[model samples]
Target chain A: MSTATPVTAGADTAAVRQAIATTARPPRPGPLSTALTFGWRGMLKVKHVPEQLLDVTVTPVMFLLMFTYLFGGAIAGSTSAYLDYTLPGLLVMSVLFTTVYSGVSLNTDLTKGVVDRFRSLPIWRPAPLLGSLLGDSVRYVIAGTVIIVVGVALGYRPDAGVTGALGALALVVVFSFGLSWVFSVLGLLLRSPNAVMNAGFMGIFPLTFLSNVFVDPATLPGPLEAFVNVNPISILATACRSLMDGTPDGEAITTSLVVAAALAAIFLPITTRLYRSR
Target chain B: MTTHAPLAIEVTGLEKSFGDTHAVAGVDLAVPEGSIYGVLGPNGAGKTTVIRMLATLIPPDAGTARVLGHDIRTEGDAVRSLVSLTGQLASVDEELTGRENLILLGRLLGLSRSASRTRADELLEAFGISEAAARLVKHYSGGMRRRLDIAASIVVTPRLMFLDEPTTGLDPRSRGQVWEIARALQAGGTTILLCTQYLEEADQLADGIAVIDRGKVIAEGTPGQLKASVGTGGLKVRLLDPGQRGDAAGILERAVGAVVLDADPAALSVSSADASRAADGVSALARAGLGIAEFSLGQPSLDEVFLALTGHLAEERDATLEEQSS
Candidate 1:
């Protein structure tokens, strides 16, 4: 069978003219608009797979009840004192757990080629990363609020007023947000979601457990005590507890904020670099 | 459509290497504004690499490329603003519905809420997926997902669009649908750079064709120019009598002073430097009292052009399972 010539100079010229006439001018939104767009999309994704929020909602409440009742008497000789000691640790734990999901979601999006699509688009470089971090903060805040409310109901009264409690909560969220940058970087560098999840959990687990999260650092051996005393999460948790319980002023809050900010400074650029390289 | 300046897409000495493998060799291309230029090649010939560089996804090792008067290296943000890319596979989120995917892209492109919704609806209808707009993209068929992927790229109304093997896994019908969409995009005055392995696709859509092999461009021209570049045409002659094939071959060879290949007693294939020589051979055969049952002379097909230029068959490369296994 013979094939006809598909190209005609006149038709081609006309088509090209039409294409030029119809093409729209490109949009140039500022960084704030770009970040908001990314944040909005991340919120939409959270809305779709809401079962993902179960851990943040269910885990904190369960841990609050289990830890305070099961080990309170043995560890502190009384439930109320133990509840006072353990609430800060549980809050930190809840934030850590919720932040790990951010890594998992990032890994999933990368593997699924959604990140690649975003890379191909003409958006701000930090939009997706910043958006996901901000989006997961919703989960963190919800979990933190639920745990705090439940702690108050269970006789764990905050000696600090509403302002101090709010400050403590904000510190926890800011620290968790910083931690997310590290995990998002890990997710990008790792090959699989499970690998990222395992690595993230492994990294955060020791940092949380080795700290004075469950008990005072003084009760530990000298070497472990030194490590726990210096751990950033432990410092933050101590600071959080101090703010919530009106304990004596210490270097924990300032030290934790400085360390958290330093970690974010180091990791945020590394993650952005990795994302661009990919 | 004439302009004093060169074109929207202009490249020279473009090169990229992945570790030790030279993915894209020194290559040059030019596309008149709004023209659909197709890069036709088999896999691993640097089509994707070329597209990546053009799209500003990856920096080329060495080369100069400009799109819409913006240098890919220095003016990457400007180039990125003007263009959009849709890769071979679907890039839409499976967890999101078709409409959600479209709206997300639109929002990222800085469309207002009402404008994003309006554009999303327009694209869904254009791609014939309006009914499936509310359905999760994971439930979409392969064709539907591909269509949605393309629609997502168009949300920004890009001046230039790069489609890398956009129909590789699609069936014939779906391929046709995509072709129609591509043609419509061209009709809208959008410059398109299409990389495809299908020769018919290049022939159907390209204003100019570049044949790349082993990371270098082997040939470039309009389809007719490429065919003419072979500089010779072949004659397929079937003899009236099976035994006459030899006689016809001898007569044709002696008449044109060229070589003739005989496949069977009834068929003879003859090549000549030009159509006039082929006609001369046929006349000589008829004068020698041999009845010519069938005689036709024409320019070569893209397959023959590929073979003549590369000294190997296209089908041979496609049949080898080595690349696929790796």
Candidate 2:
């Protein structure tokens, strides 16, 4: 950070230009380096504009507190019983909702022409999109941490201890990463950030509400209740709940992993293709 | 005066269209190594589309181009390696500081951590943005952001650069600064394909200019050559007395050999092959006993050449394009 002798535009530029030309672009960087370079770029955004973390921090904690206090009595006949059932579901919801930011961020970057600048560079072409997806993992982790701490403070305990908690957290993060690819496509296709956000909410809100996030799937109406049972959100919620409660449901966990893997397989290529063509 | 310099860019019959709009209709150009080639046009004249094609940001749809000897379509990665593009606006990340943007670019260019850090510092100071290097690009002035934008591209000083309207939306002072940057880069043996709407910019910076209009290169030459192409500088004669106007006009026509056209009611103008011819015409009118109030030589402006080539003012042509797009 210290300043060396300031070289103005008119200074000894010949040597600088020569050095740059002869540098030979340093052996084509591997894909990991390219992705990390862009990942570092995305991480800087969260560092500089920490307020970007508001969704992961304030929103999740508020949802945890509101859900536990407001609906605990009606749903479980007591707040403590409700806390155990709802906390895992709420964790899934928080991470799911946080995926919207990925879409919004990509749309904003495109509109600003930053993505165009990245496109012109000689680095691995898909790095920007991949790095952005990886960077959003930070948000998922933050949301998970906030919800866990808040839930623990409100007298909820994870029966499966650190191993179970880590497993469940991994599932949530992986699920969100795959989900981000879907939003990345939305970001690439949408004309504006607001439109991306609105579309994202429209797609996400109903799934989260209709799934077994807040209530037991059995109590719902006929067809709507059937839809909730099969929803990915419900599958994820069941997986996380079982893992955190010391009884990892192999069937539920397999379904969540396969669904996440499927989301990524389906959307990653689609997003990358749309991004390059643009 | 002749030296074997490799062509920095050689492109032919390039074509691109957005739906029905032909953004770049068949075009050809050869930019000399270490020279600044200007692409002059009004807005939406396909200037950007051509630069994009050469810079490997997009495909040309038809035709072939090689940048620094690498093909644009098949060898696009190679094309991108040797060139950098700073688009019309400062296509830089505003979220990061100038320093961070530079470092990021350097890292992407495959520089090591310490090397990129050193290079970033060197470029920050070189572009005169050292003091504001830590400030976010959003906080930089229009001029500062542009300087950083160009600086970022040089993290691995590209052998060729595509600067699309680098001075647009800038104040006169900033425009001059950007021009200075272009000059400095050219001095460093960089080939520049500069696209601009300002005739003066092309005149000042371009070693060769391609004046494009309606998705084609209407004309191409150096500033002096393009001007001279319209015609040799004109000769205008004004008679002091209205009575002698007819006689003066007649005498000047025979003197200059070219037909004299009435520039207005009071003045007669004709093309002169050179300054000496205008000088001779003036004296001939004097010897013919014609009282001339004032006579002057006029050199054709680039606007006049543009008008002749396009059949309308550049502004009018750009307006038409805008109207069509809207």
Candidate 3:
């Protein structure tokens, strides 16, 4: 074929030269911008691999349906009444459960070569960690909204209505954001994504279940009840329940916020340190 | 020997260790600006470790390196701003499309929304990955992923580029394409630090090569000087008549230093350090009235040089390293 040219011909060489000849580099991006860009990457991952959403979305929906139907009448004398009590708790459970994936995805990034690319860039060090948690907050919102919508469809009605539900979701999202830092630490410390996944679920499962999400702390033994009352998940769930009940518990809300803040304070630095050293 | 040639990378007494396995012992390198400097080594020869330390991905236990005149440790921000790394594995995000990967990097590099998209498209087109730009990178072939990886690195036209085994797992055609791209980058004045295990790759593209073994540079020179250091240029002759090979071997040993008969029975090769001696051996064969079907003289390949320097074949160490690492 006369049309064929040499591999390193004029066209290819010219193109490569033009691509890499720019002497002027754009000013380095600020930490917030780089973090947001990484968040965009996380969102794109969700868009491409929608299956990852099944854990956060479908699992919670299943829990909402199964818990309400299986023990609704036995626990609260009726399914509709049980939905009112369990809906807010389920929102907290769903969102917190979704936080585990933040670690899974972070570990996945570490295993892949892409983390090296990100590390070598001139961007902020914690941008990937913070930005991915930001993206995962979206997943938390999805999980919370799905459970609330599904509960409402199953005859749940909050005393404070839509505004109350939205407030509760915001609170739950903030808590999940803090909790995600713990998993980000796990993701960095662990060697494999599967190990991070297993460890994350193992830690989160007991914390969520041992709390008042599925049952009242009053129903447990004295020591178990004490553990449940002190559980941060239980306090968060209490704040969410009060918000949806139109009677905001000031003490419960303050404690949950403080606990979430403390998690961020302690784990964020640890996660960043592990990320840098690993 | 341009004494004043500005070095793109200057490493001194660089050291790193992973527990007991001293990945990089004391080593040094001076890479000239705009040159393709090859770090030729087998697997686990501390090649990746050295590049990682220089790229600021990991800290060295002891050492100081200046990349583009900025200290890799203290002035890391400056070095990062001017350089990029294409790691041993394709470093682009696998979940994102080819276009998205470039756009993401462009955005991270401070381009505006529209500008990042424009630059991404330009790179996708330049790298000949425009057709698969919309497809997820996980679906791309090895060559396409490598091109996209390189495109992502140059989103802002880095002053220095670190290519860690860029053609490691690629097919021959893809490897050639990568070499072409690398040469084109060099033409545009990008100083490339290429790491590879394949001797031919270094021989083909490296203007200067550092032969690294056991976490240290055993030798550093142009490919010619390295081959010459081994001191054996082979002269192989294939005869028309198999019976004359015995007489030819005697003539070659007399003129050259040593001769080894080939398995083909009609062929024999002589090892000579001097080009004049090789030519004299050829003439001596002709004078003896021995039939000479064909004969050629060439320097010892880098494979031979690596073996003579390391006491083991490059591939032999590679197999052991691969097994241990995996």
DockQ of each: 0.20, 0.30, 0.41
Give TM-scores for every candidate, taking all chains together and pairing residue i with residue i: 0.80, 0.85, 0.88
Better of 1 and 3 by lDDT: 3
Candidate 2: Cα lDDT at A245 = 95
Query: Which of 2 and 3 is the better model by lDDT?
Result: 3
The digit string of per-residue lDDT tens for model 1 on B217-324 reads 999888767666765666767778887776777887776654444445676765444777777887888888887778787545445556677976544233222122
* Candidate chain B TM-scores, in order: 0.76, 0.77, 0.80
lDDT of 2 at A234: 96
| Clashes by residue pair, model 2 | B240-B293
Return the candidate ranking by TM-score, descending. 3, 2, 1
Candidate 3 residue pairs that clash = none
| Top candidate (DockQ) | 3
Tens-place lDDT per residue, model 2, B98-169, is 899999888888888898898888877767788898888999988888888888878887889999889888
Q: What's model 1's interface RMSD, roughly to a tenth of an angstrom? A: 7.2
lDDT of 3 by residue, B130-150 (tens): 889899999998888999999
Model 3 has a DockQ score of 0.41
Better of 1 and 3 by TM-score: 3
Model 2 interface Cα RMSD in Å: 3.6
Docking class of 3: acceptable
